[model samples]
Target chain A: MSQMRLSFLLPLVAFGILALVGGMALYGTLSGSRDPTQLPSVFVDKPAPQTNLPRLVQTGSTTGNNVSVTMFQGKPVLVNFFASWCAPCRAEAPALEMLSKRVAILGIAYKDRSEDTTAFLQQYGNPFQAIGMDADGRTGIEWGVYGVPETYLLDSNGVVKLRHAGPLTRGVLETTIFPALEALGS
Target chain B: MMIATGLWRTHILIGLVLLNMAIGLVFISATTTPAYAITAEEMLANPVLEERARNLSKQLRCLVCQNQSIDDSDADLARDLRREVRSQIAAGTSDGAIIDQLRAKYGDYVLLNPPLDQATLFLWLSPLGFILLGGLIVMMARRQRGAAIATELDAAERARIEKMLASRDSENRPKT
Candidate 1:
């Protein structure tokens, strides 16, 4: 009788475990850390991809000016991919502004018109030291960008230390970005 | 009778023709590929290269859509990736190299079919594990049920039951 009772209870125990696992997965998804959007970047700890793009031409600047990844070597820099059309890019403007005081930031205007980019920056207050124009988005593809407003932190030697897929917020800056920057002693 | 036989043969002929048509329809539908997202401008002029690109595109996931393959998605990124794949094929890059380059950039998540690795081993084998677990549970229950049906009484219990039955039999016996 005892053996029979144990056998009958076995399936109940299995169901309890399955339900617990499912509940934890749901809780993790709801809490935002396990969001589908926050995929870990494959470029972390790897050398930054080669980047040579036309500089976002300003009203008085020459068209021949270009920006490349090598130019930011020997000092920690933040490579932010943003677009004038992306709403989150606008949202993150203030955080980027604050971060610029501590670290050098290079902006890549992803797949946006120069005029629009110039307009956005004028409205948002430009914080980047320099900006690149990724007109056709080939450079964005090379950098493995799935969406706009992605940011990568590169160490002084030009290796990618961290990548945040969405807009930078105060929580993100405090929890993830600042710690990563401290790790590199930037 | 001869006329009836001729009509019967004609009916059989019609039936055979209908069956053949049904088979033909199934074959045609099975062979047709649904090229949902490929645009005319994205197709290569070279047929061989275009075929290679199409085959490769089916393997890549559209990161924007997350569920559909790049070949099936109409998103902008998917279009750009399709163009990139075509250009690589035109440049004589091998299929493995093209996939590897993308995998290196996007990680294993970009592959529509996840590669078998240490991390994915349990995922691939989970069905087998579940089936074994189910079998074990069933076997245990069956063994327990068999034991219940064959449950034996101890010597004292068996003797007491027999004695009661014997007494009842005696009480029912006719007075002689």
Candidate 2:
């Protein structure tokens, strides 16, 4: 009789455990601690992709400076992929400007024309130390960038330590960026 | 009876309508082609390479538009990916190598059909586990029901059943 009672309770116990797990997941989603759209970064703990993209050049200049990963070696830096066409990139401009004061930031203008990017920088207040032109988005792919306004933090050794997808709002800076920077000891 | 028949006819008509709608949906989906996002500029000159590129594009998920395959998505990233695949195929890169490269850059999420791995083990096994659990429960229920029937049978009733079975078996036996 006791065994039968226990058998009857087995499904209930299993359901309780499943419910608890599901509830925690839902709570995490609701609390902004988890983003349903966020994918696990394969670049984390890996060496950052080396890029040699053209610098956002002057209008009249036939030749321009090239932006490369080696230029920022031996110092922790942030690589931000942004495009003039992307609204979130504009939204995060001020936050990127604030972050630039703390850490060196190399921006890659993804799939945007040079003139538009220059105009955008002028309007939004250029915070990037050096901006690379990813006009074809090849560099974006090499960096595993799905969309613009993606930020990655690299350690002094040029290893990617963290990746944050989406706009860097003040709230994200406080909760995600600041802690990640602290963890990196930067 | 006429009213009852009319109601039954209405039910059958509704069922037929539902069945027709389901078949119509299947037919429409089968007949319609997805709007191809591959532009002329991205297409390879070699027909073979272009064919391979197209096949490869269908396998890759558009990271921007998570639901659509790169072949079917007009998103800029998907267009870039299509171009990349075509260029790589033209350059003599094997399809497997190209897929592996993308998988390495993006996680398995980039593939529409996720591969079986440690992360997806439970996802792959849950159906089998549920089936086995259900089978176990059904078996246990049957055993418990059999025990209940045996317990309900008194010694006299059991003897009577046994006697009845013996006579029935003997009656069915072939004459020698």
Candidate 3:
């Protein structure tokens, strides 16, 4: 009788073990997967980090004064991390140029030499109001930058409205970036 | 002479295996230098703070690498974060404050251990809760079955059991 009674538990225990293993596997996959659309940037909706950086010397301009992130406020600004070596940065250049006409844009040239950056700007028309040199990528770290060609939009209040990890295409600009900017009101 | 030859053969086989293992260990050790990222030049001057830095680093995630702690990562960002931690320690920042600053900057995802808050409460507790619920269901099923056996047996069923035992007893009786 006890044996028969215990037999009922066989499937139940087996199912329990299966459920446990499956649940853990699913949880691990879901948590570890960096699905780009669902990527959690810690900076979104948080205040932008303030860091002091030296201005990149523009070929045609004489302004050598350093720029600080805190100084650029009261209007929405897009902070772009780019390097001369990053291929995507070149690909996204025109899109940034297009956006710059309608919105304020700043560039942080991460880990690039001065001549290389100047040459990159010459090749791809300059779109930034001020270019900060993040030669050591220290300031990039402060801003939670992981890679080049990442764009962050800060609302007028200096709060981060959006972070796009890859190179920007016009389609993404129109669909996602524009909507967020519109909602944030410049 | 034959036994000595066999013994030498055994020793040569064992020697080859040990030699392979030693070479494997040497290669592994050569590649693992980056895992211990701290160089003498980079370590904090104070031994106490240096110890804390190592412990703190193990609790932080390497953003670029999947499932690796900053301590175990050789990525550039991981190195930057390590430098940041060491600099903070040198500047006399409290460990909790530094962790909080990083959490604020990078979010809870950067921490190796997720926080047990209201939203994540389920994440931390669900597996155990599920197992316990499963156990409870099985126990309840077992108890219900046990009760059915004692109280729900039909009269014919009871009589059948009596007859079976009676036959067993008769079979055991002494044969003439």
Clashes of each: 0, 0, 0
lDDT of 3 by residue, A31-64 (tens): 7443433346788888888867878777633255
Fnat for each predicted structure, in order: 0.64, 0.72, 0.60
How big is the RMSD of model 1? 7.2
- lDDT value, residue A186 of candidate 2: 72
lDDT for model 1, please.
0.91
Identify the runs in model 3 with alpha carbons over 4 angstroms from their true place. A1-39, A60-64, A184-186, B1-34, B144-153, B158-176
lDDT of 3 by residue, B109-163 (tens): 8899999999799999999998997898778777877787788778999999999
State in Å the error of residue B113, model 1.
Answer: 1.5
Q: How close is candidate 1 to the true structure, as a TM-score?
A: 0.84
Candidate 3: Cα lDDT at A180: 85
Please list the C-alpha lDDT of all candidates, in the order they appear: 0.91, 0.88, 0.85
Give candidate 2's TM-score: 0.82
What TM-score would each prediction reach against the true structure?
0.84, 0.82, 0.74
The Cα error of candidate 2 at residue A11, in Å, is 6.7
- Candidate 2 - chain A - TM: 0.88
Tell me the tens digit of each residue's lDDT in model 1 across B31-132.
998768999999999998899999999999999899999999999889989998998998999999999999988889889999999989999999999999
In Å, residue B103's CA in model 3 sits off its true spot by 1.3
Query: How do these models rank on lDDT, best leading?
Result: 1, 2, 3
lDDT accuracy of residue A162 in candidate 3: 92
